[model samples]
Target: MSYLLTAPEMVATAATDLDGIAAALYAANAAAAGPTTGLLAAAEDEVSRAIATLFGAFGQEYQAVVTHAAEFHTEFTQALAAAANAYAQAEATTCSALNTFETQLQALLAPLLPNAGAGAINPPSITSIGAQVAFIMGGTGIPDPDPMYVTGAQTLFIQPRFPGFLSDALHTPEQFWPTTPNLGNLTFGRSVAEGVATLSNALTTQFSTLGNSAVVYGYSQSAVIATIEIRHLMAQVTPPSPSDLGFVLTGNPNNPNGGVLQRFTGLYVPVLDVLFNGATPPDSPYPTVIYTNQYDGTGNFPQYPLNLLADLNAVIGIVDGTHFYVGLPPDQVANAVHLPTSPGYTGNTDYFLGLTQKLPLTSLIRPIPYVGTPLAELVQPDLRVLVDLGYSDYGPGLSYADIPTPASFLSVPNPFAVSYYLAKGAAQGVQASLVNLGWLPPSYIPTGYPYAPSVAPGLNFFVGQPSVTGLSLLTGALGTAARDLGWIPPWWD
Candidate 1:
């Protein structure tokens, strides 16, 4: 057999379309019937019908639940295959070019070997271990749909950033980063509270499997989880390794759950620490890089477009004016961890990774200003060191631009916004998402989590009807009272 030096491992979790069957049954008239006339037959009909109805409903729900998950998984598999092929072609061409260039260079100079010309050669054999991987997590809200697309784009984008060391153009993400199928336990779309444990477990699994250091990257909500988990999920636990690096790019929880008032009060950091099993994150050798976006004041002066919308919604009682807060600077905008949606004014992008300043019309006029998502400022010092990607982050090749924020109304069709972002992702010519919407577009941008309503009647609904959709605390907590703490679910087990 031809010895295989390296290959990308295609990872996949089967798309399970859970089986279901529906049946309608009725017994023949007991007096006239032969098979159906008996008591057993009557029982069978009733049981069959009941079971069919429930099972059918269960099947539909399961299908609905897995719909996004399965679609993204397929996209991921296909994208990886395409990326792997692209990488292979590029690598072959590059190697051939390098070989030709090296041959000519050797003729001009001396041969460069494992050792530089003159030292005494000893039995210094070099043993090699496999490559290290860097798994980047995406922002949240609608889960399951985002991760894979993020990964696909990430696979191509991450390669160029590490020119100093790794240069495996043909490598796949499984070989380069995350080495496995899970993004923490982010497979099923669940709220962050419930979602964190899965991510924690995923990290534990990767570290256990690799036994070598790796990079962990998290953006937005993913940043929060990665930051909290750095100490615990690191490869060597107590004895940290320099090889491990956790990049918590952006995810700033500026105000507790943003401006939305919760039914019950909960401390943001404290709750995190509790779930993480300590008052503070433990110190580790792995370093973390944090990239924050600055506040944009453009939406405030003439009045942000969202304010106008919020005003209209308030007049009709769609949203209460008391609870809805706007007109704050970008940093103060409680967007939790995402870029402010529908930025009315063109804010500055000085904080973006690789954007250049435009020259002014004249000396009197100032250079065009820039800004980024205000969430990047948040960082946790307890766990790891922070490397802030300031107004601009420059590597060897490309610049990360604060591509203009799209201004649109709620009425703006999603496809319109989607096409724009996708084009941007493609045009930027990088493996990054269009302004970090993750791999896939958000399924839905929830206005708020907990979604607690200050209205008492809403609170009554929450407490009285736990199963109510849209209005329940699980789905929507439209209440002023803390009848339900609405604690986030499925903390790391």
Candidate 2:
């Protein structure tokens, strides 16, 4: 079941939490500069690490400063949370003020939002493409009347979490399968297989009434499931019943181990053949788009440490030509008229660094909320105020079914995804889609940083002329995937 939190509820939770974090910061500063100082310094280091991680292969001097600022914010919040009533209340008041200030700031930019209009990519048919474990639902929302989109489509968008997200979301991004107790408990492939299995079973009966619907393998993660599951399903002779089959892989990963730590190359060959071997019509046979980001760390063959993975992601794909195509090239960087001719020469590192510096640290690090407060509010309540409504006891086995979907996840108010994609230099069509769908700023144009067009107001990340074209490939692949799924125009031979 999905639930929506009011704007006030969201603000209140954040105000309360920020109040706590502010107090923590003050305490950390005032308290003994020994242990507290150590913690503060560690946080600073962590922030630096996070910043460096964002750069991929490039690092900058400001990145350290940004890290320090983030750490300070974290320490402040932690200290504030631990403070007594006097400090906590004061901190809360300060947070309230900040919230008010933030509100006014947003009000100023409210006009930039897309004007309400009919959405894009409406599905025309419900082509059923059943899989054994789960039916993959693409991540990006598809508009109605789009051939691929079935009104109440049931699909899964599952993939391994990026490294940064591990620290950002799961708390331990480094812990691979069999490493961390909670995460490692289940086999990586097994979990995906299970999700597919359950989806297939439930969707079979659900789609019966929905019409001749199909399963869409969307996004890198969804594509991962589709590729792996297809390989597994192909092993069986009579692979269950199905309405219709299609694998609309957008920005699809050619290999299971293509992400961080894992780097298997040429793994997507079979899956590519399965979808686009000229066996099916232009739209049929599951269109797959191997999206490659020219600026993506993976674009540089030697940059990604693919050998680190124990078994998966063992092989490496070529970047320019020899590579097993994964994403788009650095079109964003290539368009830059004035390239950063810094001391070092070559590659997209210079461009990426330039862009990284543009995003301010203050925007990236979200303030921490109060202590003893609900976990939902303590971590970024503004994104979506999710006050725990008596749903905690279910410890380890917390599935999507256990919790309600927030308005933000289902209907994200902000276009963080679009902004990020734009920064990466996505295709004009995809950018247009984002703008048309009210996903991003309408006037936002893809240009080489420093010279290319204007930057969006209120964007925290600094934008130097990006030297990478990763965004181009990434957007192109995603666009291709969207087309395959009947969200955009079909791909031509």
Candidate 3:
């Protein structure tokens, strides 16, 4: 029972008289200049000269005004067309929803009715009414597709690294970020670098097969992998357009590469900004999230390779004459990166000041550069953009979770999870999916659902179990963690 509203019919037709008015005005002016055969005797002779000046000025202005009007008309027409298209799409979605609800309501009510007579809310008539919401079939023109397109709904979820004992030797840059599409070996499991490169290759294939763009999510070492994946895509001659990509980053190591963020807009939570002295650049469509929570002790672990000297970051900060991870006050939660978090160094004030308050003095071992650039600089720009986006009050929800004691930092995962949900919350598109799936709870859920488990379908972390020399271990724990966090598939022996 829908009816269309029509515009009021009482308006005057002034637009129709514009041409007639112009013609009359022109004729009147032209007639005034006719038959100037005899010159005026004295001062009156200047009338024709004055008329010529007035008409000349008016004609020049008139031409300019006409050009401006045409430009305005073009802009307005385009705007109108865009508005009409949006209206049509919205109307169709709403109508379909209403019809479905109506059909369901009728089915329920029909049974309750004691008298199912022809005049008593007939279901058949309602079905016919629903059928009337059909497409108009008379248009002949086909419009060109828009140049900037964000087509299809798909997500690319990247994962962070797990806690493990490793070394600076594991920073195999060549294997992690290969220049060619022919991905190198698969058995380089000593570092997250190899894992990331393998994952990148698989993701490219998966994205292509889906025929859709993706929303990449990453944290810690995995954050590095996420950017690398984008790099891989851009290297192609016909790279995927930026509109097709989106990011949901948290605790990333470096400032996100502007090359990608400028194109694909998304949420960036630099929960780990201290590593690169808070580098959040301003080149994103959305505001970045600056998160620092009490329980994230990982920041305290001097982002130098896991097995490299623990206090190496502090040494560099001291040598550089300023804190490398500068800009945080002692009271803040993110300042934990500046504070030493190991059990031995927890209560030691001297250790907090970058000295050997409770160590074997083993930090003298400084590792050589593998990837490129000084280590800190490499990690700086990647996460700096996150800081810059949040530099003003550190973006929305820009406060710390204040852990009661520094002792509970590593054990409690809640602080990190809090910021993780915040990142997802900022991505409205991802949030919509959660609302539809009913997985999001009022209370916090410890496990994160791997939106797409097979994102890196056949990624190999290390070639294989030591028993098998160079064979690809199709089933690996790291890849499983990358895919699904809510409930990971069991690891193979």
For this target, which candidate reaches the highest lDDT against the unseen true structure?
2
Number of backbone-clashing residue pairs for each candidate, in the order shown: 21, 73, 18
- What is residue 327's positional error in candidate 1, in angstroms? 27
Q: Per the 3 Å backbone cut-off, how many clashing residue pairs does candidate 2 have?
A: 73
> How far out, in Å, is residue 87 in model 2?
60
Which scores greater on TM-score, model 1 or model 2?
Answer: 1
Query: What root-mean-square deviation over C-alphas does model 2 reach?
Result: 26.0
Which residue runs of candidate 3 sit more than 4 Å off their true CA positions? 1-190, 234-236, 255-493
Candidate no. 3 TM-score = 0.21
Candidate 2: which stretches are off by over 4 Å? 1-184, 199-211, 217-222, 233-243, 248-252, 255-263, 266-284, 288-493
lDDT for each of the candidates? Answer: 0.28, 0.29, 0.27
Pick by TM-score: 2 or 3, better one: 2
Rank candidates, TM-score, best first: 1, 2, 3
Instruction: Quote each prediction's TM-score.
Output: 0.27, 0.25, 0.21
Write model 2 residue lDDT over 1-493, tens digit each, in one string: 5522122222333446676665675565445333322322224577876654555323333444545765777666555444434444553564466445534554554454221121122122223433222233432121111323321122111121001000000011111145335544433333334445544554455446533334443343344445454544455575423334334343333321122212222111221221211110112223222222221222211112222321111121222222222222334323322211222112111111111211111122323343212222122212111111101111111111101111110111224322332333323334433443555553432233211222121222111112122432443454456456654311111
**Model 3 clashes, total count:** 18
Tens-digit lDDT string for candidate 1 (232-283): 4444435334444333333222111111111111322222222211111212
lDDT of model 3, residue 79: 56
Candidate 1 regions with alpha-carbon error over 4 angstroms: 1-128, 141-157, 160-190, 209-211, 234-240, 251-284, 296-493
